[model samples]
Target: MHNLNAIVVGAGMGGLTAGIALQQAGYTVELYDRVKQLRPAGAAISLWSNGVKVLNRLGLGKAVADIGGQMDRMAYYSSTGETLTEFSLQPLIQDVGQRPYPMARTDLQALLLNRFGAEHLRLDSTCVGIEQDEHSVTAIFEDGHRATGDVLIAADGTRSRLRSEVLGAPIERNYVGYVNWNGLVDAREDLAPKDSWVTYVGDHKRASIMPIGGDRFYFFFDVPLPKGTASQPDLYREELSQFFKGWASPVQLLIQRLDPQTTNRIEIHDIDPLPRLIRGRVALIGDAAHGTAPDLGQGGCQAMEDALVLTNYLQTTNISVEDALSRYQTARLDRVADIIKRARKRSDVTHGKNPETTKQWYANLKHEDGRDIMSAIAHTILSGPLN
Candidate 1:
């Protein structure tokens, strides 16, 4: 084992993953989070094949598999409830050698948090700034406490305070031209297949529900909307009902069944790729490194990949900490930027930013076989460092 200790800011998925990976590499890991109790930002995350691969490497494969949704089929419908296409995801799984797990964010978080061990993680500690010298780095907290380590990792998320310090300016997030309302509900066949992911598309909007663990389904409604749209507490049901009016039965049922009070209403946003992800011994990962629209459901997956890659460099290279971070940046920058750009373009097309393109996409959906879609997914999974 190398003689190194690490400080991780943020207890989100990426940070926890990083902590676990680094610990397995025999590094002392201290994790800090701003929240008193961890609450997931969204309802669920679609852990793609690539993401699952990372978890498997971290030795949490069976635990995650047991807690994740068994999503093996995907279907799409038109506004009038006509089936566009339906196909089993088995082919993709076979091709990629791993299955995608669509699980509740809460469960995923708990699993990672447990694996990382809560004893080593500090809560309700907000990171204010950092100071690094030639030999070590120190994280300053809002409460005037400091934790110094061999290296500092800013997995603090998209609006990371440390991001500003590393980049020399605060980067603004670009709105993806849509309002998303998401929540979880008990899985019922009337709402959607218990094991299938279903989506209804029309009018520059979509209502989707995917099966998750614990006999429940994770659901979301997406509608094109202007930025800074005003929202009120417990208004999700009424707002989604109005926006998704005249849609299919499953879509209506999803909107009706999901609780308004617990639902999360968010305006989607993604940042342009950063010029770099490392500054000396301080490195960025997850959303801080490459925030992307969730159109392709790769946000969490990419973050997991970041943790794995960063850990790999730090453990395997036998290089200086700074050099390891620089190698990680070189390994990650281009790939994550490409995924972010693709997700942005897909978001634009889905939300009617290009009306013609959106129309064409809707038309093409009717003729789409599950092959092309699965092929595309397979290509992405294969492209990740896990392969």
Candidate 2:
């Protein structure tokens, strides 16, 4: 019999979502993070219909809807401010049974953390090592304490130590030859239209603007950079201004208002898709399993879906730990791998250096009924494993 205890190795979206699903699946789950407090470190996260579907299973869909901003449409434009294509999000909203919302990444984290009280979560507890045998797993902490559980879930993100232990060396974090900047600007009444999201594409760069809450819009910029380039913190804002000099309207205004401290610059990275996501009593979830560029906004959603299905597998099957882990891997690998591939391809097509070709591609997608495409993808997610 598989024991009903689990240790989750990170407090980010994947870890907390896993804890919730496992605990509710009759497991006693203890979640840990190295950070003293779990505040929102990044800008905003889009709760695509798939993400909200998992949230609905948790009974927090309404809470997410309450705090998140809804958009009826998404429009794409050229850097010269010419409209290229547009699509309605209404069909996707109806298919998921909930409207897609853009909530401040911090706000969503706070809402998820409240589901499990502080007692189940240990802040500032760093997991340094994981030891496992045929039956149980033990986690070694940096503070000189050890805790054992039936299973250890490594959601510790891209630089996972548990991953290193399982694979026997540090896996290289591959950069995509681009860096992204993101921040949430204070809601300016005169700026961005309400209830709509916009993305503007330029040669070798892309910018996204979307509402996250009542007044705030989440903005992201992905700019091309040479591989292995280090960015200077002190000159980020000035560098950004110079990098995007004389782009589009509103975007120029938005960039002008950003506080240097609030903006974050990260080199986009992805791990080559793994052949498997589990090893004995330890299984990897989220980015640890498959990290990819954010071009598709499916990273968090895919992780939440993994957590849900993993819990379902463990609860429904009277199988050994290895069997359960294997089942989880079986259920997730292909779907996630396909997504990773699609996301990489989409990034290439979206930010293609040849502006004319990129424009032609977007035009073709626009004319092909994007709502139908979204519906098909949604069906794949909701019906694939959970059904």
Candidate 3:
């Protein structure tokens, strides 16, 4: 038990996970969020084995399994509905010793909040600045109030104010030159198999459907577009219909069933890897530290990993707080940097930023028997600190 207090900014996955892990480590945790209501930023998260291990370690294994979607296979298809390659995820699951959970973002957030207790989370408090001395760190809020703690964690996400404070420079988020429209729809066989993660790719566009808990499908469509495009919240269905026009029937059906109100559309962006993750008594975690493209589906998973690893260092290290944080940075820097670079490459390839690379990838998928895909997944799962 550390017997210290932690002030965590942002009540998203990483922040809430940090709150729970720190509480378990005998630290009083206070979580603050800018939004009045803590709405999850995404529709669903694909919890790979590494992320699931963190939840299990937090004593939510059964709860997560009960609520998470049971994904048995992963299949890739062309835009015209022709099967490109398919593989059972069972072998990868066995190799990793844990199952992946494709869960709704709201459901996962509710679970974390239940575990960490909603009473400890303070909403409608936006963090504006941070100040720290040799003894403690203080989080300055926009509401003319401040909170001080033994340590402060900046998990405030991609546009983090604390990041600049920690690094002493204003960081810019790079536009990935694509737009993603995502939403949840009722799960039906005609749309996609309830137990499979399916993707349709062609013309530098991607449409994916994954079964989520409660008999629903989490779907996303990716398209190459200029950055800073205005969101068409009211006309999402119409835009999607046109964007994916003349594709497969499953995609059309899914689009037809989508409710415009629930569909979320946003331009994708990510920050370059930070030179460092800590300054004084403040440390950055999750998206604030290393935001990346969602092409690899590791964004939230990496955040969960951040929570567990940071907690482990704080609880197990007998060293000073600053020393422990430096250790955390040392342990995380290389892995996250590699993931960021890989995700960037993947985004480029998937969106046909380089037409030759995209063509090669599609060509390779035709002959892939899933071994190469499974090996890639296995390598990523094995590279985590948990292994």
Candidate 4:
């Protein structure tokens, strides 16, 4: 048992980021995870401008940049490979105060954990229960171990046990009816391109490829598959091959070269936006608070922003812990909820039953200059309780 402190559950990006922020704010912090070791579990993720901005403030920007690929432009194209719209990301970052970087999930985690140091991390400690009063929080782990802190942050992610304990079991995780298969591919000679994110949109399917570090290309595809479709090892390559066969240029080639052993398929799930993310001394962040579709690639970025904003509030306000939690919820709910709605709406448009409607919607999207839309989003994320 320690003195007044902040205890963070889960060593995922959200938890680690919060731990870093809290430590820097002069709070004693301990981060716990059930896993024996923290390894990059899945694949690559694009750290958007908002996420990088917070990391830069933490002085980890240069370290992270050392392990990531800088994206100069994001291009959207039709299923037939017709470029619909392209945006310059460099200037956008200049206006927004941060640049977007793409890197492996492991890379980002490693950098954060390295900075936090091993002594502050507790592995194999799963928080199964929590008790909180106005002044302190006590956590009970699966192994029957116990720890207490002044504040308990539930950054356990979408299926967070802490969230379930605080809000009761979530209504249910809504499945979007499509599964995404993602992995890194060795960029073919002809496929190798410089600093760009390319998205291919089809009737009910979409694929995106972004440059990660080195010659490897990070890729993912959202394909319409029946719910609970069990994937087998031998059929991995064949299944993806059939799904994207004859779709467009590079599709066939990418599928052919994909190694099933190295690939991962995940069913997408999201939640209806909630009106609040705080209760008592327990506060939520990341997917635990806002689980959105990856349409905008804002999932991790929003989590990072939540961390930054929450820490900023703690530092700026001389208020009590409960008041800080209230302020954090008030400041974060609307912006994050709006993003959730937007992500769901975009998913419906992209994966709607009607192919023609999707194409039409995309065409309309092309006509709209996205600068203003992006700027509005930037404003919401950067302007927190200060506004």
Taken over the whole model, the C-alpha lDDT of each candidate is 0.90, 0.79, 0.91, 0.79
Cα lDDT tens digits, model 4, 145-220, are 8988878888988887888776766647788768898888876545436577778877688878888876678889
List runs of model 2 lying over 4 Å from the truth: 1-3, 353-359, 362-387
Q: Is candidate 2 or candidate 3 better by lDDT?
A: 3
Better of 1 and 2 by lDDT: 1
- Which 10 consecutive positions of candidate 4 have the poorest summed lDDT? 378-387
Candidate 1 deviant stretches above 4 angstroms: none
**What would the per-residue lDDT of candidate 2 be over residues 154-184, giving only the tens digit for each residue?**
9988777777776666788777667888988
Error of 1 at 372 (Å): 1.4
lDDT string, candidate 1, 291-351, tens digits: 8999989989999999999989988776589999999999999989989999999888888
lDDT of 1: 0.90
Stretches off by above 4 angstroms in model 3 are none
Scored by lDDT, model 3 comes in at: 0.91
lDDT of 2 at 151: 82
